[model samples]
Target: MTKPPPTTRPVITPSRVVAGVCLVLPFVAMLWVGSYARVTPALLGIPFFYWYQMAWVIVSAGLTSTAYLLVRREERARKGDGR
Candidate 1:
């Protein structure tokens, strides 16, 4: 009988690490509010703390999208479809 092809396990790559960082940065930023809790370096008169959180809204979206793309690309590559 012919042997079946080996199944490959998913492994962490640089892209995956970047994806992880992208996914985690927003959470860390928000959770550590004390770092941005200030009035200086305000943007257009908005307080630093408030503006920082709001900025993360857009940043988070980008980061999420980036992470998603990175993982998806890696998955595709693993599936032998990256070319």
Candidate 2:
């Protein structure tokens, strides 16, 4: 017997894209070792390597929160609860 055809998938939206970027930025920043693997820029005497990661800690939180809020709003609107 033949297999069934696939169903339609959800289309990507701006909100979802923003959320994806929010989640990916932190990983990219941390993984790009050559970018921050240095001691030239120091934060209160902390090496660039260490300080860069620390800054990302805060940046990640903000990005994550923004993404959460954006997607959440979209979901709520879809559910007819955009108040």
Best by TM-score: 2
True lDDT of residue 3, candidate 2: 86
Model 2, residue 82: C-alpha shift (Å): 12
Q: All models: lDDT?
A: 0.89, 0.89
For candidate 1, which ten residues in a row score worst on lDDT? 74-83
What is the C-alpha lDDT profile of model 2 across 1-83, one tens digit per residue? Answer: 99898786785899999899999999998998999999977888998888888889999999999999999888888779532
- TM-score of decoy 1: 0.78
Score residue 35 of candidate 1 by CA lDDT: 93
**How far out, in Å, is residue 69 in model 1?**
0.7
* Tens digits of per-residue lDDT for model 1, 15-61: 99999999999999899978997898988998788888888999999
Clashes of 1: 0
Q: For model 1, state the Cα shift of residue 49 in Å.
A: 1.3
Query: Between which residue pairs do clashes occur in model 2?
Result: none
